[model samples]
Target: MQLGLLYSGGKDSTLAALVLERFYDITLVTAHFGVTDEYEHARQAADAAGFEFRALELDREVAEEAVERMREDGYPRNGIQHVHEAALEAVADLDFDAIADGTRRDDRVPTVSRAQAQSLEDRHGVDYLSPLVGFGRNAVDRIVDAELDVEVGPSEEIPRADYEAELRAVLAEEHGEGAIREVFPDHDQTYVHGLRE
Candidate 1:
Protein backbone atom coordinates (compact mmCIF):
# COMPACT_ATOMS: atom_id res chain seq x y z
CA MET A 1 0.00 0.00 0.00
CA GLN A 2 1.06 3.55 -0.63
CA LEU A 3 1.56 5.43 2.62
CA GLY A 4 1.71 9.11 3.38
CA LEU A 5 3.89 9.66 6.44
CA LEU A 6 3.70 13.08 8.05
CA TYR A 7 7.29 14.29 8.09
CA SER A 8 8.94 17.18 9.88
CA GLY A 9 12.54 16.65 8.75
CA GLY A 10 13.20 15.48 12.27
CA LYS A 11 14.75 12.25 13.39
CA ASP A 12 11.49 10.76 14.62
CA SER A 13 9.61 11.30 11.35
CA THR A 14 12.59 10.31 9.23
CA LEU A 15 13.02 7.13 11.23
CA ALA A 16 9.32 6.45 10.94
CA ALA A 17 9.60 6.65 7.18
CA LEU A 18 12.56 4.28 7.22
CA VAL A 19 10.73 1.81 9.43
CA LEU A 20 7.68 1.76 7.17
CA GLU A 21 9.45 1.79 3.83
CA ARG A 22 9.99 -1.96 3.66
CA PHE A 23 6.32 -2.65 4.12
CA TYR A 24 4.80 0.14 2.07
CA ASP A 25 5.62 2.61 -0.64
CA ILE A 26 6.24 5.60 1.57
CA THR A 27 6.06 9.31 0.82
CA LEU A 28 7.51 11.78 3.27
CA VAL A 29 4.89 14.49 3.45
CA THR A 30 5.39 17.87 5.08
CA ALA A 31 2.27 19.83 6.03
CA HIS A 32 2.41 23.60 6.11
CA PHE A 33 0.05 26.57 6.30
CA GLY A 34 2.01 28.84 3.94
CA VAL A 35 3.18 30.85 6.91
CA THR A 36 6.77 30.25 5.92
CA ASP A 37 9.01 28.50 3.42
CA GLU A 38 10.38 26.08 6.02
CA TYR A 39 8.70 23.14 4.35
CA GLU A 40 11.54 23.12 1.87
CA HIS A 41 13.80 21.82 4.65
CA ALA A 42 11.69 18.70 4.89
CA ARG A 43 11.79 18.23 1.13
CA GLN A 44 15.58 18.42 1.19
CA ALA A 45 15.80 15.98 4.07
CA ALA A 46 13.48 13.57 2.26
CA ASP A 47 15.57 13.77 -0.87
CA ALA A 48 18.72 13.04 1.09
CA ALA A 49 17.03 10.10 2.76
CA GLY A 50 16.11 8.70 -0.64
CA PHE A 51 12.36 8.95 -0.18
CA GLU A 52 9.63 10.42 -2.30
CA PHE A 53 8.53 13.78 -0.93
CA ARG A 54 5.43 15.93 -1.07
CA ALA A 55 4.09 19.05 0.58
CA LEU A 56 0.57 19.06 2.03
CA GLU A 57 -0.75 22.58 2.17
CA LEU A 58 -2.86 23.25 5.23
CA ASP A 59 -5.50 25.93 5.80
CA ARG A 60 -4.27 29.27 7.10
CA GLU A 61 -7.40 29.53 9.24
CA VAL A 62 -6.32 26.51 11.20
CA ALA A 63 -2.95 28.10 11.79
CA GLU A 64 -4.65 31.17 13.11
CA GLU A 65 -6.84 29.09 15.41
CA ALA A 66 -3.84 27.23 16.78
CA VAL A 67 -1.95 30.44 17.38
CA GLU A 68 -4.88 31.91 19.25
CA ARG A 69 -5.24 28.81 21.37
CA MET A 70 -1.58 28.85 22.27
CA ARG A 71 -1.81 32.49 23.16
CA GLU A 72 -4.76 31.84 25.46
CA ASP A 73 -3.27 28.81 27.16
CA GLY A 74 0.27 30.23 27.46
CA TYR A 75 1.41 26.83 26.29
CA PRO A 76 1.50 25.03 22.97
CA ARG A 77 -0.05 21.72 23.99
CA ASN A 78 -3.65 22.24 22.96
CA GLY A 79 -2.79 24.33 19.94
CA ILE A 80 -0.30 21.73 18.71
CA GLN A 81 -2.76 18.92 19.33
CA HIS A 82 -5.32 20.79 17.28
CA VAL A 83 -2.92 21.22 14.38
CA HIS A 84 -1.77 17.61 14.56
CA GLU A 85 -5.30 16.28 14.30
CA ALA A 86 -6.02 18.58 11.41
CA ALA A 87 -2.81 17.55 9.68
CA LEU A 88 -3.72 13.91 10.10
CA GLU A 89 -7.09 14.52 8.54
CA ALA A 90 -5.46 16.42 5.70
CA VAL A 91 -3.08 13.54 5.09
CA ALA A 92 -5.89 11.03 5.16
CA ASP A 93 -7.66 13.06 2.51
CA LEU A 94 -4.87 12.19 0.12
CA ASP A 95 -4.86 9.18 -2.19
CA PHE A 96 -2.67 7.04 0.01
CA ASP A 97 -3.99 3.80 1.45
CA ALA A 98 -2.31 4.44 4.79
CA ILE A 99 -1.13 7.47 6.75
CA ALA A 100 1.40 7.70 9.55
CA ASP A 101 3.19 10.08 11.89
CA GLY A 102 6.22 10.02 14.13
CA THR A 103 4.63 10.79 17.46
CA ARG A 104 6.41 8.84 20.18
CA ARG A 105 4.84 7.09 23.16
CA ASP A 106 5.82 9.72 25.68
CA ASP A 107 5.04 12.80 23.64
CA ARG A 108 2.70 15.01 25.63
CA VAL A 109 1.23 17.05 22.80
CA PRO A 110 0.22 16.27 19.27
CA THR A 111 -1.13 12.94 20.38
CA VAL A 112 -3.91 11.10 18.61
CA SER A 113 -6.13 9.30 21.01
CA ARG A 114 -7.34 5.83 20.04
CA ALA A 115 -10.81 7.11 19.36
CA GLN A 116 -9.51 9.85 17.12
CA ALA A 117 -7.39 7.38 15.19
CA GLN A 118 -10.36 5.07 14.76
CA SER A 119 -12.54 7.90 13.61
CA LEU A 120 -9.96 8.98 11.06
CA GLU A 121 -9.62 5.48 9.69
CA ASP A 122 -13.37 4.97 9.55
CA ARG A 123 -14.01 8.27 7.88
CA HIS A 124 -11.11 8.21 5.46
CA GLY A 125 -10.98 4.50 4.60
CA VAL A 126 -7.25 4.51 5.26
CA ASP A 127 -5.16 3.03 8.01
CA TYR A 128 -3.69 5.45 10.52
CA LEU A 129 -0.33 4.46 11.93
CA SER A 130 2.17 5.83 14.41
CA PRO A 131 5.26 3.73 13.97
CA LEU A 132 7.07 5.19 16.96
CA VAL A 133 4.10 5.22 19.31
CA GLY A 134 5.44 2.21 21.13
CA PHE A 135 9.00 3.44 21.43
CA GLY A 136 10.45 5.56 24.19
CA ARG A 137 12.81 8.47 23.66
CA ASN A 138 15.90 6.49 24.67
CA ALA A 139 15.18 3.78 22.17
CA VAL A 140 14.50 6.27 19.42
CA ASP A 141 17.74 8.05 20.17
CA ARG A 142 19.66 4.83 20.00
CA ILE A 143 18.27 4.07 16.58
CA VAL A 144 18.97 7.56 15.37
CA ASP A 145 22.51 7.42 16.65
CA ALA A 146 23.13 4.18 14.83
CA GLU A 147 21.24 4.77 11.62
CA LEU A 148 20.63 8.41 10.79
CA ASP A 149 22.55 11.61 10.16
CA VAL A 150 20.67 14.12 12.30
CA GLU A 151 21.59 17.53 13.64
CA VAL A 152 20.41 18.26 17.16
CA GLY A 153 19.82 21.73 18.59
CA PRO A 154 17.31 23.97 20.23
CA SER A 155 13.91 24.04 18.51
CA GLU A 156 14.27 27.68 17.50
CA GLU A 157 17.57 27.04 15.79
CA ILE A 158 16.84 23.69 14.21
CA PRO A 159 16.23 23.67 10.48
CA ARG A 160 12.99 21.74 10.40
CA ALA A 161 9.59 21.95 8.75
CA ASP A 162 7.44 20.87 11.66
CA TYR A 163 4.15 22.58 12.39
CA GLU A 164 5.72 24.20 15.41
CA ALA A 165 8.06 26.20 13.18
CA GLU A 166 5.26 27.44 10.94
CA LEU A 167 3.05 28.09 13.91
CA ARG A 168 5.86 30.05 15.53
CA ALA A 169 6.27 32.11 12.41
CA VAL A 170 2.56 32.90 12.33
CA LEU A 171 2.45 33.78 15.99
CA ALA A 172 5.53 35.96 15.72
CA GLU A 173 4.23 37.81 12.67
CA GLU A 174 0.82 38.48 14.16
CA HIS A 175 1.61 38.81 17.84
CA GLY A 176 5.32 38.99 18.57
CA GLU A 177 8.30 36.79 19.36
CA GLY A 178 7.49 37.25 23.02
CA ALA A 179 4.09 35.62 22.53
CA ILE A 180 5.62 32.52 21.03
CA ARG A 181 8.41 32.42 23.58
CA GLU A 182 5.83 32.48 26.31
CA VAL A 183 3.96 29.61 24.72
CA PHE A 184 6.96 27.49 23.76
CA PRO A 185 9.73 26.93 26.22
CA ASP A 186 13.22 25.96 25.28
CA HIS A 187 13.38 22.41 24.03
CA ASP A 188 15.88 20.38 22.05
CA GLN A 189 14.91 19.48 18.50
CA THR A 190 16.43 17.54 15.63
CA TYR A 191 16.81 17.83 11.89
CA VAL A 192 17.52 14.73 9.89
CA HIS A 193 20.15 15.06 7.18
CA GLY A 194 19.78 11.50 5.93
CA LEU A 195 20.61 7.91 6.76
CA ARG A 196 24.09 7.65 8.21
CA GLU A 197 26.91 7.14 5.76
Candidate 2:
Protein backbone atom coordinates (compact mmCIF):
# COMPACT_ATOMS: atom_id res chain seq x y z
CA MET A 1 0.00 0.00 0.00
CA GLN A 2 1.11 3.57 -0.57
CA LEU A 3 1.91 5.38 2.66
CA GLY A 4 2.76 8.92 3.69
CA LEU A 5 5.40 9.17 6.39
CA LEU A 6 5.39 12.33 8.48
CA TYR A 7 9.05 13.25 8.61
CA SER A 8 10.81 15.84 10.75
CA GLY A 9 14.54 15.16 10.19
CA GLY A 10 14.75 13.86 13.71
CA LYS A 11 15.94 10.40 14.68
CA ASP A 12 12.48 9.13 15.52
CA SER A 13 10.73 10.17 12.30
CA THR A 14 13.64 9.11 10.09
CA LEU A 15 13.83 5.73 11.80
CA ALA A 16 10.07 5.31 11.52
CA ALA A 17 10.34 5.81 7.79
CA LEU A 18 13.13 3.24 7.63
CA VAL A 19 10.90 0.65 9.28
CA LEU A 20 7.72 1.43 7.37
CA GLU A 21 9.39 1.41 3.96
CA ARG A 22 10.24 -2.25 4.41
CA PHE A 23 6.54 -3.10 4.17
CA TYR A 24 4.97 -0.33 2.16
CA ASP A 25 5.50 2.00 -0.78
CA ILE A 26 6.32 5.01 1.34
CA THR A 27 6.66 8.67 0.48
CA LEU A 28 7.82 11.07 3.14
CA VAL A 29 5.58 14.07 3.91
CA THR A 30 7.25 16.80 5.93
CA ALA A 31 5.84 20.02 7.37
CA HIS A 32 7.88 23.06 8.29
CA PHE A 33 6.64 25.96 10.39
CA GLY A 34 8.94 28.41 8.59
CA VAL A 35 12.22 26.77 9.61
CA THR A 36 14.05 26.43 6.32
CA ASP A 37 17.05 24.56 7.68
CA GLU A 38 14.83 22.07 9.44
CA TYR A 39 12.76 21.62 6.30
CA GLU A 40 15.86 21.09 4.10
CA HIS A 41 17.36 18.60 6.52
CA ALA A 42 14.19 16.50 6.44
CA ARG A 43 14.22 16.54 2.67
CA GLN A 44 17.84 15.38 2.57
CA ALA A 45 17.12 12.69 5.12
CA ALA A 46 14.28 11.44 2.95
CA ASP A 47 16.63 11.23 -0.06
CA ALA A 48 19.28 9.41 1.97
CA ALA A 49 16.66 7.00 3.25
CA GLY A 50 15.48 6.34 -0.31
CA PHE A 51 11.92 7.56 0.04
CA GLU A 52 10.33 10.27 -2.09
CA PHE A 53 9.79 13.33 0.06
CA ARG A 54 7.29 16.17 -0.12
CA ALA A 55 7.61 19.23 2.05
CA LEU A 56 4.49 21.03 3.28
CA GLU A 57 4.71 24.56 4.53
CA LEU A 58 2.67 24.87 7.71
CA ASP A 59 -0.23 27.35 7.59
CA ARG A 60 -0.58 29.56 10.62
CA GLU A 61 -4.24 30.44 10.31
CA VAL A 62 -5.29 28.02 13.04
CA ALA A 63 -2.33 28.85 15.24
CA GLU A 64 -3.02 32.51 14.97
CA GLU A 65 -6.69 31.91 15.69
CA ALA A 66 -5.89 29.82 18.73
CA VAL A 67 -3.62 32.52 20.10
CA GLU A 68 -6.30 35.04 19.52
CA ARG A 69 -8.74 32.94 21.50
CA MET A 70 -6.22 32.58 24.31
CA ARG A 71 -5.67 36.29 24.38
CA GLU A 72 -9.35 36.99 24.82
CA ASP A 73 -10.25 34.03 27.05
CA GLY A 74 -7.17 33.98 29.31
CA TYR A 75 -6.60 30.30 28.60
CA PRO A 76 -4.31 28.51 26.21
CA ARG A 77 -6.44 27.15 23.43
CA ASN A 78 -5.38 23.72 22.23
CA GLY A 79 -2.23 24.68 20.34
CA ILE A 80 -1.12 21.18 19.33
CA GLN A 81 -4.55 20.36 18.01
CA HIS A 82 -4.44 23.55 16.02
CA VAL A 83 -1.12 22.40 14.60
CA HIS A 84 -2.59 19.05 13.62
CA GLU A 85 -5.49 20.80 11.93
CA ALA A 86 -3.04 22.83 9.88
CA ALA A 87 -1.10 19.70 8.97
CA LEU A 88 -4.27 17.90 7.98
CA GLU A 89 -5.23 20.74 5.68
CA ALA A 90 -1.82 20.66 4.02
CA VAL A 91 -2.08 16.94 3.26
CA ALA A 92 -5.80 16.81 2.60
CA ASP A 93 -5.37 16.51 -1.12
CA LEU A 94 -2.50 14.04 -1.28
CA ASP A 95 -2.95 10.67 -2.89
CA PHE A 96 -2.09 8.07 -0.29
CA ASP A 97 -3.68 5.20 1.60
CA ALA A 98 -2.17 6.02 4.93
CA ILE A 99 -0.30 8.66 6.93
CA ALA A 100 2.54 7.75 9.29
CA ASP A 101 4.32 9.61 12.04
CA GLY A 102 7.27 8.84 14.32
CA THR A 103 5.43 8.14 17.52
CA ARG A 104 6.73 5.42 19.83
CA ARG A 105 5.36 3.57 22.83
CA ASP A 106 7.72 5.33 25.18
CA ASP A 107 6.48 8.66 24.01
CA ARG A 108 3.29 9.66 25.70
CA VAL A 109 0.44 8.57 23.51
CA PRO A 110 -1.53 11.48 24.83
CA THR A 111 1.03 13.80 23.24
CA VAL A 112 -0.78 13.03 20.02
CA SER A 113 -4.31 12.25 21.03
CA ARG A 114 -6.52 9.44 19.87
CA ALA A 115 -8.78 12.12 18.49
CA GLN A 116 -5.90 13.54 16.46
CA ALA A 117 -4.89 10.12 15.18
CA GLN A 118 -8.46 9.27 14.42
CA SER A 119 -8.93 12.57 12.66
CA LEU A 120 -6.07 11.79 10.31
CA GLU A 121 -7.61 8.46 9.41
CA ASP A 122 -11.27 9.30 9.60
CA ARG A 123 -11.18 12.75 8.09
CA HIS A 124 -8.82 11.81 5.31
CA GLY A 125 -10.19 8.34 4.74
CA VAL A 126 -6.75 6.79 5.19
CA ASP A 127 -4.80 4.77 7.69
CA TYR A 128 -2.71 6.53 10.32
CA LEU A 129 0.21 4.34 11.22
CA SER A 130 2.98 4.69 13.74
CA PRO A 131 5.59 2.06 12.87
CA LEU A 132 7.74 2.90 15.87
CA VAL A 133 4.90 2.59 18.35
CA GLY A 134 6.55 -0.34 20.10
CA PHE A 135 10.18 0.68 19.57
CA GLY A 136 12.26 2.85 21.82
CA ARG A 137 15.49 4.85 21.56
CA ASN A 138 17.75 1.78 21.58
CA ALA A 139 15.78 0.17 18.78
CA VAL A 140 16.20 3.34 16.78
CA ASP A 141 19.98 3.31 17.39
CA ARG A 142 20.29 -0.29 16.24
CA ILE A 143 18.24 0.41 13.13
CA VAL A 144 20.33 3.45 12.29
CA ASP A 145 23.54 1.50 12.87
CA ALA A 146 22.46 -1.41 10.69
CA GLU A 147 20.64 0.15 7.76
CA LEU A 148 21.28 3.90 7.38
CA ASP A 149 24.47 5.73 6.40
CA VAL A 150 23.67 9.10 7.94
CA GLU A 151 25.47 9.64 11.22
CA VAL A 152 22.93 10.25 13.98
CA GLY A 153 24.49 13.36 15.39
CA PRO A 154 23.59 15.36 18.45
CA SER A 155 19.92 16.18 18.07
CA GLU A 156 19.82 19.23 15.89
CA GLU A 157 19.63 22.54 17.68
CA ILE A 158 15.92 22.32 17.01
CA PRO A 159 14.41 20.87 20.12
CA ARG A 160 10.79 19.79 19.73
CA ALA A 161 9.84 22.74 21.92
CA ASP A 162 11.73 24.98 19.55
CA TYR A 163 9.09 24.37 16.91
CA GLU A 164 6.52 26.65 18.49
CA ALA A 165 8.94 28.78 20.49
CA GLU A 166 10.96 29.84 17.46
CA LEU A 167 7.82 31.21 15.82
CA ARG A 168 6.95 33.10 18.97
CA ALA A 169 10.54 34.31 19.36
CA VAL A 170 10.82 35.56 15.83
CA LEU A 171 7.56 37.43 16.22
CA ALA A 172 8.71 38.96 19.49
CA GLU A 173 12.14 39.87 18.18
CA GLU A 174 11.01 41.19 14.82
CA HIS A 175 7.73 42.83 15.68
CA GLY A 176 8.06 43.67 19.38
CA GLU A 177 7.43 42.00 22.75
CA GLY A 178 4.01 43.59 22.89
CA ALA A 179 3.09 42.06 19.59
CA ILE A 180 3.80 38.58 20.90
CA ARG A 181 1.83 39.22 24.06
CA GLU A 182 -0.99 40.61 22.04
CA VAL A 183 -0.96 37.40 20.04
CA PHE A 184 -0.21 34.88 22.77
CA PRO A 185 -0.66 36.65 26.03
CA ASP A 186 -1.47 33.47 27.90
CA HIS A 187 1.54 31.59 26.55
CA ASP A 188 3.80 30.44 29.32
CA GLN A 189 6.01 33.41 30.04
CA THR A 190 8.91 31.23 31.15
CA TYR A 191 8.91 29.29 27.85
CA VAL A 192 9.04 32.44 25.77
CA HIS A 193 11.82 33.93 27.92
CA GLY A 194 13.84 30.69 28.00
CA LEU A 195 13.59 30.14 24.25
CA ARG A 196 14.85 33.65 23.64
CA GLU A 197 17.67 33.10 26.15
The candidate maximizing TM-score is 1
- What TM-score against the true fold does each predicted structure earn? 0.98, 0.66
* lDDT tens readout by residue for model 1, 1-197: 99999999999999999889899999999999987899999999999999999999999999999999999999999999999899999999999999999999999978988998999999999999999999998999999999999899999889999999999999999998778888999999899888888
TM-score of 1: 0.98
By summed lDDT, which 10 consecutive residues of candidate 2 come out lowest?
188-197
Q: For each candidate in the order shown, give its overall lDDT on alpha carbons.
A: 0.93, 0.59
Off by over 4 Å in 1: none
Worst lDDT 10-window in candidate 1: 176-185
Estimate, for each residue in 76-96, the C-alpha lDDT of model 2 and write its tens digit: 335444565566556655888
RMSD of 1: 0.8
In model 1, the Cα lDDT at residue 190 comes to 92
C-alpha lDDT of residue 161 in model 2: 29
Local error of candidate 1 at 92, Å?
0.4
